[model samples]
Target: MGENIDVVVIGGGYAGVMAANRLTRRDDVAVTVVNPRSVFVPRLRLHQLVGETHDAVVDYETVLAEGVRLVLDSATGIDAATRRVKLAEGGDIGYDYLVYATGSGSPSPRVPGAAEFGYPVATLEAARRLRSVLCDTPVSAPVTVVGAGPTGIETASELAERGRAVTLVCGGALGPYLHPRARRTARKYLARLGVSVIEGSDTTVTSVKRDAVELGDGRTVASQVTIWAAGFSVSGLAERSGLRADAAGRLLTDETLTSVDDERIVAAGDAAAPSDLPFRMGAYIAGCLGAHAADTVLSRIAGDEPAPVDLSFPAMCVSFGRRTAIFQLARKNDVAVPFYFTGAAGRKLKEFSCESSVEHLVNEARKPGSHHWPKAGKHRPVVLAAQRGESAAPAARDT
Candidate 1:
């Protein structure tokens, strides 16, 4: 056989790891995952980490295939012309195909004093640091959580359940992704858990102080600790490396997940912007993107055209402490439906979703290409129409 196809995946998170394991399906491909850490961070449990309820770390040995190499280092840049990835620690590694899955981080807050006074709990290290500080804080101290996304809700609920006074500051609607009915149910559950839900256009933190958080409306909430979980931002490595990237620094790719600037470079997860539109950042979509990237490489090696990605969101889960949760069912377009799962049933489903995410990776390692998700209704018709050389409406861009 000729030289083996060297595939270098940058990142050890869900997407990168899944891509690495799935690449093992072909003996001609050798996968190397270069990440800043050796252990996998179960991002879904980051809130539990702050509550000291879960460690949220997984050994790579249990999730990676035997032939995949793990490089505990960060990618500084990529020389696509030479197929070489620059490493932060030192030298460079050459590859025949590159999977850009650097993922994302908790976005830097724009409010004054937020960076210096607020704590972020997006990664394992950050979560551990937040947990340590919480341990030192008095149990009765008022803690404020800014941002009403899933992370913000989960963090506030977790802290309230642990006896810390938590106030969820929603700059807008709480759980905007949830339908009005589902959101009402969630708010009630959080209220029962002793969490204060503040929702308003002017509720955003204008400034964060060591002892309090100032809102846009000039109201101040007494706080001993401030947790920020507003949004996420991808690294600028792709843009810096001269690759085509969107405004957020996510690598731009075609529908097949192949880089628009470089065909050999495939992107997945939050860092991938396909056709100027990116999928929402979540474990389910990330896994689907990762697996699709792998399939693209294998198809190329077999001299066949790669298929475009087809994915959908079945539901969204949010935990309001250990006992109460809400699973918001979605339509094909990802619009939350009025019907939903809540209470103990929702909690069980949330737990299952978290656990099964890990299981999906491990099972993929044992049997590549075993992981599969249903395609959204909108995507299926478009794809089929394209195959038949017929024009179709564009897929919905909303998450």
Candidate 2:
């Protein structure tokens, strides 16, 4: 190529786009982002398929920073020894600094036939397909959601509220990390909405077979649409690139978010597993780490010491529906401090929070490198004191 680019960001998700926009804002740096898609998928709001807010998203064309190049291709691997990224179609591009933010893919459901038949909302395409199937397919059709976390709960609730027969096959109680009361309350809400909650089922999804999912228990559910929302896995690109990855295949980084083997390489979002201070795969931490990664690269370029970044995060916000949510407050160290907000007012607060996060993305992307980050999340006095465990500790954030 002409010359090695300043920064090459992989995965055009929230973190990659934010970092590219920020890096290109400096005017002195040239940034290139590589991804397989044309648009930046708003993955967090994807569960509300039956609602208008379900389609919320920001196009990358409208927000990409100046002097930043967009390469439409999937990264097959990286030649870290030569500081080059191998693309599926756009060929090899060299870079001085690299940021991998490909995010995570939906973990394959383990129940028999789940892999072959389960529909997942992990990606924009998957969500779109699920939306189409639900809208066009038979109503009252049995739809089984095989997850109970934020995505699964929201999906099942949205489907059930819309008059669809939804069976939320929660592997655990709904909101397992939430306080006992919160979990009970969520279950009550779900039960009131005609959602069938199945808990403590040792589900082994063998594969997906058209319209039905077969569990290892030899039980079969006639689900016209089966969604797999259980866990996540990083793209194998990191492992293929010969980076220092962990057993789960996440790129291993230091407290400062630098690759353990190469300081010039940085990782954010689900693609990153920062040692001594790991973060969850939420967008909240991606924004923080994206900004931090940019700062680390900028400081190094300027021959200054890379400042240490504390994994300081406040809390997590989860939406149950359009008018209800749970703002789970945590400690400064990110343990749930038994805080909970619910009902209509809680829903409004959730709306405010989601809108504010969207606005921050737009503002920061529009300005490209304004060095803006979210202030810590505030909590209400109703902190659910009943929950003070390490599961709240998290497998742990835009993180």
Candidate 3:
């Protein structure tokens, strides 16, 4: 018997939950997850919450391992030199190791009036606020959804399917991550839902106002409810703590998810920039990273070298309301291919993925070290080499 290792994981999103649960594998390690909310938020289904279709929250008891302690509070800063996490409320908690998995949120909008007038659905609180606002507004109100990313597309389509007049303002192409054919499919589906799909270089939102959104082309669209789904930004906790972070404020890490400056700290999910090249933000990747981060800590405790991250993307799925979706297949490198699944098939796959993301946490809670992900292909090394200005041969296939 020896002193138990205390590992504190900040944030209880997909990544944090997975990391906490997986860390419970060792009897000698104690895991504590710090989250602001008491319940787990199913972020992918947040649009459903705004549409009044789903609540988008799960009890922490259902997903968190019984051995893992759940701390209901936000982390304000990290005192890495003292190995302590400062809580927003008052005291700090010391940790032998720390997992920096604060996830992400809507960036502080810089567009004029956007911060004051626009509604973002990136967090549970934000989604609930938007849901309440939508409930109070008339169904006929014109809802303008900014950004053409998956969140924007889902929100617009969800509202439109609920009989609300919705306009999706895509600064550029719709579903920029999708193949051209897949993008066409998404556009067609949006049109079918009676959603006005606005696209093109000139369609960028210049400013958001109380009653309308101005466009780069000098056009103004009437908007009773303005939803900003443009993108996500990580918290400044790491940067505020004086840790090396990427330009996006994600903590800089090595290939093994260890902090570049301190091996005692690791990062996961959207808050981690491994090798200064982060994976695309999603629950699938987040869960894998969380599990890998746990393994890295366990390896260090056992005096073994932690293995580098080896995960690859298989596809990207975006829902159009509840009945339809587009599952765009991609290579291991995450570049979309020409093929895709849509209609009923895509919807089923998309729903399964959403469910499985949470189920991964629950399963990991019940059986630590049970989750597994696909290994990264040869593309990452070649890309890294090119970034370093070293010549490299092309990979035979990404997957």
Candidate 4:
């Protein structure tokens, strides 16, 4: 056994990166991140697949703390009782602490052949697939996007800008988390870009076959390509490992973002569903939560009480294409209100969110004591190869 406890992190997304970057600030606790990938895939900018925003993929070697270790293996199961993670490979690694940040996967409703026929637009692999198809697929082709959340909106809008016949099928109000004004404004902006958004009391998608979507009201729309942009489903890692999970399979966390059953085992990003807040995972929250998770681990190692994590919702930018967009201002209790800004202004806000996430990671990695950033490593992909490739793109403009 090592003098300091080994902190094993699962999944290498925004939450895992932030957690790992913050956690290793102290010299006491050892950190190990197990993930299948090495690069910090910036998912928010993934909608650019319809466009040309490939510059968003981040390299983790520059952001991780000096001593943090990265392992490239797929985590198959978690043993909470023994504090050991069962890997798909031949080894079993034990951890003094565990952080579950497996994040979400593409959710498919029981809608006919949607699972088999639908083209995914969320995960990195899915985006890559979509990119390959889009680059080969003809412009003005019929692309059906289901779901009206942030991901759906970005995907549909960006696709429409490319002159594709985009039909966004929303089950409920568009951007339910966004304020009513913003929702209306978003609807209008989407329409302006030639996106046919179907939303009404009876508008619903019951099933989606390879060529068409069966609506709830017995209406059928031709969909050459269908994209599922529905809600997020927490990874099965925590659920299979016997950890306490809510209805959505997210690990139950306390106010400090650590698992309720185990103090050493914390959660971050989308995979962490704090019993108190029960967040609807986003990068804005993941980055902050990741930092806090790291801080808590470091404080424990220092024999000090970890600080409480308090996250409040503000506005988030929604890109409506390269030309049009909406700047939503979300209040404490309500959804984001529409600021009615588009073009460069809304794009600037979107860019700000990206910068804010990356900057927080860089600063917290350099200064561990400033604010609590947890040390969690979940992605063991290609980043461990030590490629210090700097961003060729301009510094993402801040808000």
TM-score of 3: 0.97
Candidate 1, 1-399: lDDT as tens digits: 248889999998889989999999998898999998878888999999999899999999988889899998999989999999999999999999999999999888888999999999888889999999999999999999998989999999998999989999999999999999998998898889889888989887889998999988889999899998898889999989999899888998877889888878999998998877788889877888999988988888789988777788899999998887998899776789998999899999999999988899999999999999888756655654576567864332222
Say which candidate scores most in lDDT: 3
Candidate 4 on 1-399: residue-level lDDT in tens? 578778988877777877887776666778888888777777888888646655457778766777888888888888778888888876878998787878887876677788888877778888888788778877866899988888999999988887889999988778777767778778888988899998765667888887898788788989888888876676777778777788888888765677877777888888876643466578877877777777777777777866556565666778888665677776543255545456788788787876777777677678764543232232111121223244322111111
- What does the lDDT come to for candidate 1? 0.89
lDDT over C-alpha atoms for residue 212 of model 2 = 71
**lDDT by residue (tens digit), candidate 3, 86-115:** 998999889999999999999988999999
lDDT of 2 by residue, 1-399 (tens): 454447999988777877787786566678999988887776777886443355756677666765678888988988988998887885788898999888887776555666677777888778888787777778878888887888888888777777788887766566666667677778888887788877765654445567776555676667888888888878888778777788778888865678887888988878887762356677767877787787778887888976545455566666766667777776665666666788886677767776665555566667866755443332211121223322222211122
Ordered by TM-score, highest first, the candidates read 3, 1, 4, 2
For residue 372, model 3's alpha carbon misses the true position, in angstroms, by: 0.6
Give the Å shift of residue 178 in candidate 1: 0.5
Better of 2 and 3 by lDDT: 3
Error of 1 at 195 (Å): 0.9
Give per-residue lDDT, candidate 2, residue 352.
78
- Candidate 4 vs. true structure, TM-score: 0.88
Candidates' C-alpha lDDT: 0.89, 0.73, 0.93, 0.75
Q: Give stretches of model 4 more than 4 Å off.
A: 338-340, 371-399
Candidate no. 1 TM-score:
0.95
Per-model TM-score versus the true fold: 0.95, 0.87, 0.97, 0.88
Q: In candidate 2, what residue range of length 10 has the lowest lDDT sum?
A: 377-386
